[model samples]
Target: FEFIHPEFHEIVRRRLQTIIESRIVLPPVEQRLLRRDGSVVDVEVLALPFETEGGVTLQVTARDITQRRIAEAEREALEAALRQSQKLEAVGTLAGGIAHDFNNILSAIVGNTRLLLEDLSEAHPGWRSVKEIRSATHRARDLVKRLMAFSRQQESQRSAIPLAPLITEVQHMLRATIPAGIELTVRVPPDTPTILADATQIHQVLLNLCTNAWQAMPTNTGRIEISVTTLSEEAARAQSGTPLHGASHYVCIEVRDNGAGMSSETLEHIYEPFFTTKQPGEGSGLGLPVVHGIVQTHKGAIAVTSRPGEGTSFFVYLPACEAPPASFESAQRAVMRGTEQHVLYIDDEEPLVFLVQRTLERAGYRCTGEMNTARAIEIVRQAPDSFDLVITDLNMPGMSGLDVARELLMIRRDLPVVITTGYVRAPDVAAARDLGVRDVILKPDTIDELAMIVQKNLTGNR
Candidate 1:
């Protein structure tokens, strides 16, 4: 009786008393037992009434069930993780489809607006209105970009990024969104190593983390700290409670908030999709899951810790690289003019094709636009040398952009083939390059960017 766990003492006592009074066997009751060493063990207790020389005696049996319980718990956790993964995959597919269609529409609008702005003088009556329209489209484009990031559909353009500047940029952006009550601080050592990652995605990661931190504060008044440091593989493993594979050193970005923290139960479901503790209108519950996905995609890891009223800290560990930080040069404002180079453009979207045709023509290039892939291929096949460059949309009804590039390149080995897409996968980019593609450009590029690419390819600049 004294050896039983305190919580289960009454249960064991009552079961034995019932068996003694009724002089019959009772159903088994599961409870816990404390060993001599003060360790707890789960046991199934069954009491049996035995007929002895005396009145009635109760015989108790307890089989250890600790291992069984542990196994069941582990299985349940794995099953939950699997379900969450499937849900994310479904959401990603839906988001990618929506982004693709929306980007196509945005491409046409952006292309036409750029052309209009160039043709109209700033003093015109509707110039400001058109400019505002263009600004709205830019915002819409950014929203779609976030959707792509969440869906994991955007091809990451990775380079060596210095954390100091990236965090500073994110700090400035967060200041505008968070309330005045929250105090934000940043501590980054100048010697922090650079990480090979997509700058935009990492930016998004920091933004999401800080946003979550501020919202977790109950009084809307707390200190949020952003810090960067280097960690060895072993130290990272200890901090994250997970092994770090392949990389010896890691760049750790820590976001800490002194706010109303979370319970262990809340932390368990934090990465599950659509699981939010916030009020209905406050959150969609996709932030942490998106952060988890991005970290995994970058070959990195993220760990978090929180306790009720204590605070929360998220540690993002990305493999450190020794490469120098990437440099950014502003794109030239002036559009590169072509010297009457005949260009063949193909896309299923008629409006996009039309806009590209006019835009290219305005930039001193003779352009031919086609909506049918078969006809375009036939034209290229019939007279391969007629067009100096070939630009085709990636996802067409009859054929894909890679196929178009392959067919055209086979016809004219020297012809420059550029593939453009609204949504491109890494595999497709690799396949396109393997097929001798000159370049792959994302859709809805500014007129100057398009002209520059066109000029670069035509001039045979590798």
Candidate 2:
């Protein structure tokens, strides 16, 4: 009861005032009573009135009901939590469905745009516009990926990633989003060990944290700092309020901001879904929750601290790996040239199939496109050696790309096949690999990527 409310004088005065003003007999009512030692307890009161010699007298009976009240409160809390869980589950289902359809649409746009860029030289008048379109579609694809992530439908490709370079890349991108007045700093030691995690998901986690820090400073005039450090078991355990278990090495990424901090009440519910401090249209309150999900998926933990008028700091800790970080490079490679090799491409999406055919043909390959899986299987069955390679979309009506690949492999056991998909799941990839799939290509792949895969598989370089 002390935890509920330490003082009850005002509450008692208010109830007495209401009862006196009515001057009518009332049934039992719930009230708070302060015991002799100053602890508060819940009580049920029944007041009885009788006529005296000169005035009316009232007698009251107080029944202690603290246990019952506590039980009721707990039941109500559980009910509220259940309701919130159901609501969020529904939202996730809707978002995932929308993302699947949206990704397919984006794939078509991305594929066609890349094909257009292939035919038009840099000196062409429409080159810049086409490039811009492709860039926009890439951004759209990223947004879809985030939605899939929040819905727990997107596949994460985990690898050994260096923190310094990844943080540097994100820092450069964030400079444009934050205001000029805000000072942003990043400090990642070169010797920091690599972590096995999804690079894109890590990028999302970092970006979302920084974005929240930016929003926390409504004036857009504050300092934000991002730092990475390797933590020993003792140091890591000290940093988290929750128990740290079974991890010897951890990499800590800290984002600190000197802005308006959160109140105690606000901090308590910060990670609750749909709980937001921003005005309407300013935030969806899903940012922190998404960050939480991503970190957990990577076998990591996150913690936050804040005080009103002070600042806020978010700490993310991921298990570290001894392996050297993988290097990321972007350079123009020679376009893969294919011999007059016959390739069979199957996709339910006609636009994507047509775009892929045009792109492959330009790369000097003889290509055939099939929108129907049964027809594609017939072609493969009729002439097992007709096509040198098979490329099929993973998701389709009636027969999946994996099913087609299997049927094709049955006709010609050594036939190489690639799986293309707009959406991917870890289990799906594992299953495809088990089926002897040579490679899996994510949708909206550049013409260069398609050509390279086709050439590589045809040349027996899987």
Candidate 3:
């Protein structure tokens, strides 16, 4: 210990004694020290140092590590992100494979049974068995579809939808159901650009958030705000903890609630499926996870911020889509359009071909049916000008629907093909569109419904 200022050791000792009596360490000192050359050198000396019972002096050890700390922090953040991405990838891959196999099985059962029921009349004694089979198959089919969507395996029906309309619809529906004590508000921009998402999934996400908010505020006079606005890249990154988006354009919607908020621990685990805080039989715990999946399916990101007793907010950022082509440019309404066009329909399921032929005939279109893809292609090649449209099941044995459509197109470049399936993946749709298929119809569609789309696209009715 050195003298204080120009003072002697006695004064410094007195001050040190006082500080030590008060059980406080001496504050760090930043001063120059005399070097061997009699020149002052930059040094941070801890003066008035204390000593331990064993007589080891208490002095501060100074080291410059600001830059080191920053580099380490950055490395850690990157590693964390890589780990998360890997986990998601693994889960998504496994889920997709399982969902695909599950879907194929479902398709076989449901597709074949549907074809069978078409030939069985209501008066048939075994009709009751068929109906039961259909009912069970549908329930199982829906579950598989959900799994596929969650796993990002099922093809999304992407269309430019006005966010304002969807948000307004959801808010209006919610306001009618939510209690008066819990104020519900939707603030959407008048000119919010349309986003491409499945309409049903969007609706479900909104409903799930509203329901969760309602439960959180069972009795209180709480407030819930649903706001939609364009987000800057920085804002989106700040909320989502990633720079995965750009500042060019985005649509951000947040559901904010003034109710019992979740703890940090709960928030961290909220997106994990089946991890619920509700009592047994009270909550399914899939609501938020499904919401997470739906937003992800849209190539969007979601973030939740909460503080116990303060409130909670869930932010969803979706990329903005350009305005849709005008209504005049859209295919004409199938409900109003009449089709007299002849179609060559091919499906491995015999009953499906029969049902489709009957359906199209009833709708004024002449349909030629073939249960084999090879024979169907041969028939079309034999009479290239006979059929106006070709409708085929995308997956058929020996040759895929793509192969048949490609073969038909080679014979008749103007031929239009429509693909029907219980589930369509991204690649399947891409291949179909690449082949210039007129439309992709999800399976289990009514005959009249099928006729409408076929007529609209094939005849350019719109």
For residue 195, what is the lDDT in candidate 3? Answer: 76
Return the lDDT, model 3, position 290.
87
Q: Which runs of model 1 end up more than 4 angstroms from their true locations?
A: 17-27, 36-39, 158-197, 225-257, 260-330, 446-448
Which 10-residue window of candidate 3 scores lowest in summed lDDT?
325-334
**What's the C-alpha lDDT at position 200 in model 3?**
58
Each candidate: RMSD? 6.4, 5.6, 12.6
TM-score of 3: 0.52
Tens-digit lDDT string for candidate 2 (265-346): 9988888766789986687677898788888877788999899889999999998888776542132255457888999989
> What lDDT tens digits, residue by residue, belong to model 1 across residues 1-462?
778999987777777777788787777888889999999999998877878999887777889998999999989857765776788789888887776678789888887888888889999998999899887886677666666766677787788888887788789879998999999999999888899898778889999999999999888899999988899989988888877877889988999999999999999999987678999668767789878988998889999989999899999999998888754224335546888999999999888888888989888999999999999999988988789999998888889889889889889888999998877677888999899998887666533267877888898985
TM per candidate: 0.74, 0.73, 0.52
By TM-score, the candidates rank as 1, 2, 3
**Residue 82 alpha-carbon offset, candidate 3, angstroms:** 25
The clash count for each model shown is 0, 0, 1
lDDT of 2: 0.80
**Candidate 1 vs candidate 3, TM-score winner:** 1
Best by TM-score: 1
lDDT against the true structure, each candidate: 0.84, 0.80, 0.71
